[model samples]
Target chain A: MKTNNGSSRAYSITSILILIILAILFLFPLYWILTGALKTPAAINSAVPQWWPQEFTLRNFEVLFSKRSAPLFEIGSLTGPIIPGAIRWLINTVFMAVLAMLLTCITASLAGYALAKKRFAGRVILFSLIVAAMALPKQVILIPLIKEMSALGLYDNLWAVILPTVGWPFGVFLMKQFAESIPGEMLEAARIDGAGELRTFITVVYPMIKPGVGALAIFTFISSWNDYFLQLIMLTSSSNLTISLGIATMQAENSTDYGLIMAGAALAAVPIIIVFLIFQKYFTKGITMGAVKG
Target chain B: MDKTLSPKLRRQENISGYLFLLPSLVFFLAFVVYPMVMCIWTSFTDANMNSNTADHFIFLDNYIELWKDPVFLKALVNTLIIVFVSVPIVCIFSLWVASVIHKMKEGPLSFFRIVFYLPVVTGSVAVTVVWKWMYNNYYGIFNYVLKSTGVIDKNINWLGDSKFALWCIIIILLTTSVGQPIVLYVSALSNVDHSLVEASQVDGATNTQVFWRICWPQIMPTTLYILVITTINSFQCFALIQLLTSGGPNYATETVMYYIYYTAFKLYRFGYGNAMGVILAIFIAILSAVQFRLAKEK
Candidate 1:
């Protein structure tokens, strides 16, 4: 028994040591990006790489901003002020992500509540369809969607990106997972009190499922912001590019500009990372909750 | 309550339910279902970007040609390799990490969780570009570290060489892939019934035995989920390939997802791309079903 305890203690220590090493491995790339972004060109391009930036400079970021310019946004004949293309791309990314999150939350909660509580004719079928749709490789639909969006005259619009993201049933599936946990007794009580559908949902269901919505909101925002393929295929014009697409295009133009690319990478990654950090709790819940009985 | 509801009450329920569903259904149907239907339909016809030539019904030709096409074959094999390799690695790696870290206190646990998950939240483009630079033939950190440590004698072209390119992409895929599974497994492990574990311990079961007997079965659903998602995500690893390799160095890293994008957008063979899409969907469905069945039997 003493030997067993001794071996087990050794085993745990070894495991923890290995875990820290692996954590550093996983973290090195982000550390590389941040430091690489600040490192001067000579430090960036040296034979022996700088583990940390020796010569810190904002020249990379300055060059990135100076690379191009675009009107901030367009509204029919009226256009917003001109800005650095990188900043415009960030703005576009925010618009796309926020709008997608908002629409997804609103639509998903309503549908998810109905699926959980309503004994409608097609509830089972619709719920199944939503789950099944969540499985389909989202990129597979990009081709047909391009044709469809073009037909609707929204091929280059941010709504083109936002609408499809909202259309994907992941948010609804996740929300339904949350909605199922709302006790039937609560819904029954609300109905018994002569609360109408909208009123009960607004007053009761919304409050109860707020955590789930919070999870979905952050999740949606991050995914939409980083949805590079959809943005690449759908948004062709430079002015319409999201930050991810913008960086991708920028890299294609100047492939070996490590410092410039890292600057763009920092621009693209940092804000979303900040968002993820703030909503870490809700986001974790969203991921794990959706996998329950999945 | 549902069974006892009167016809009038059921009717009201249906009305209210459908009304609630209407907004979501509109977006789902228009954006998802319609495109899906169009994709399947287009796969049967000879569609392209030529405005003068209307697409003709040419069923099975695209699917048949896909089997004969060498690049498609290579792509299919590469995608399967990615899915098969990365799925298990992700599952095992994450489950192991979760087991160790889930025992930690809140501060350390959250730190590990966030650290593992940062790659994913870093945005794929950011992740891809940085990886591209690090894998640069001349100035990459990998070569620098290896050479300094007497591992390799010279700088190796990580993405430019056919032999190393696929594995390079897979390594990046592993970093981004483990995040969600780790999150899921952590949640699953911590939520395992503690009383049962303590009882098993009192009966003198070892930690491994306790984990296998008490925790594993309870966490099987999460395992199945991780498997399916990792498979899907691995199968759809396009951004890294696009940004880093573009399936070059003689198509060594050509994946079906990237090929589909190439076929439809780059090559303008919409029908062929859609055909490949259909085949991919079928593979995912069958694999997911097989996983579900296996998990059930266990």
Candidate 2:
């Protein structure tokens, strides 16, 4: 009995220690980011990190907001000055990502409902094609995609990025799984009660699969927001660039402006962070429920 | 009235379904399907961005030369190293953390879960910038801690050195992105049959034995899913490499995706890049098929 008690105590201690270590590991970088954004360039470059800012000021924000300094778009030369360009890029990114999400969720829910509930011709083939599509990397189509977009006069537009990702096969797959868990009887009953397919979807089905849609929305938003490769290839002008492209270009042009870069980064992180916090309950439930089917 | 119009209405329903899916299908076929066909088509040609006015056929020349291209070969090698090394480390760490959280009750455990998952919500720009600061060669937090602790004699150039660059990137990738897998593992563990665990304990099975014998088998499918997705993700890894290093230190960290971007956009070698892209697609598809087959077999 004493041995059992000792072992239990030991187990508890070990668990606590492990948890602390993991927590620190996970949280420290975030702490660093927050502090780095707040600190001055001199303080940041100091041999010993102030741990806290020596003199906190909104100078970085001021630098970001000042538009009279330079045009953000003209810094393509091998060596030239750059404007902050971060704010405009942020607006473009968020707009595209949100629009993409809305389009994806609507289309995905429809396709998912069809795949999960309806019996149709080429059902097996269509489902197989969607699954196979998940494995097809974006690289394979990128070159031709560029040509096609350019031909359509959509190149260097925000729509180019938004449209390509809106038809995400995995998003459809996830929704299909969630829709499958809904009883077929409910749909049948709705049909019997003179409800059209669209009506049933809007009324009974969408509400039931809100968590799945929410999860998909959260993920799609993040990936689209974080996306660099497509945005990089598509957007030529700095003003048209997404936040990710803006930051990358800024880093490339001015490696010395670490303070401004980190500040821009913090700004970029704020919107998504706010979205996550607001939708966290749904996000957590959605992720857990969505994982099994995923 | 119901009987008279039922068949016609059913046909209308089917039509509406197809109509509803039209936008997505059109986009997919045009952007995804058409481009895929074009990629394969271009691979068989000597099509250059500058020489688009002329047609030069080069059947299998790109593939033949790709095997010999040193940079291409190096990128392939680096990609494999990253996928294999990083995925398993991420899985193990996420599982460990998930199990710890599973043992704890809801209050604090839930808080930690949210905290860990915050990185997933935070945009890549923020994560990259944070790591760029943390992994700084001079006066960055990581080096600062290491030097202060006397762990290292001097600051190290993390994203600059060929020796440590990829590994540094991999570490950052694993640490910040453990959130998704942790969520998966937690859900998987929670859904596991508690009765089986109780039965094992009553039969005098130790926690270690139960975990090895029971939980391991149960979570195998989830693990497999993670493996497949992680492999796909590793292949798709671009932003971090692009942001931090730009495939620098003599292209030591160049993954195929990054290489594809460079070749098509920077080098004006669309044909060659498209061919390489097709090859990458085939590799991923074959691997994904194999993974699904293996998972289904069990």
What residue runs in model 2 are displaced by over 4 Å at the alpha carbon? Answer: A1-5, A67-84, A288-294, B1-13, B51-55, B289-298
Q: Whole-model lDDT for model 1 versus the true structure? A: 0.92
Angstrom error of the Cα, residue B219, model 1: value is 1.2
B1-298 per-residue lDDT for model 2 (tens digits): 3244467676775686686667768767777778878889998887777634874788999999889999888888888888888888878888888887877788877777878887766766678877887778886777888888999988899888999999988887786667878877887888788899999988987777888888877987787777777777878777788778878789889888888778887898888898888878777777777777887787
lDDT of 1 at A144: 91
Candidate 1 residue lDDT tens string, B36-125: 999999999999967489999999999999999999999999999999889999999999999999999999999999999999999899
User: How well is each residue in A1-294 modelled by candidate 2, as lDDT tens digits?
Assistant: 467558867987898798888788787766776767778878977878887787987777676656323343333454335555666677678889999889888888778777777665567788888777776776567788788888899999888898888866767788888888888778879988999777998998999888889888877887788766778788887578787777677667767767777777777777777887777766776566544643
DockQ score for model 1: 0.88
Candidate 2 backbone overlaps, count: 0
Interface RMSD for all numbered candidates: 0.7, 2.6
Clash pairs (backbone) in predicted model 2 = none
lDDT of each: 0.92, 0.78
Q: Per-residue lDDT of A119-187 in model 1, one digit per residue for the tens?
A: 999888888888889888888999999888888999888989999999889888888888888888888
DockQ, all candidates in order? 0.88, 0.52
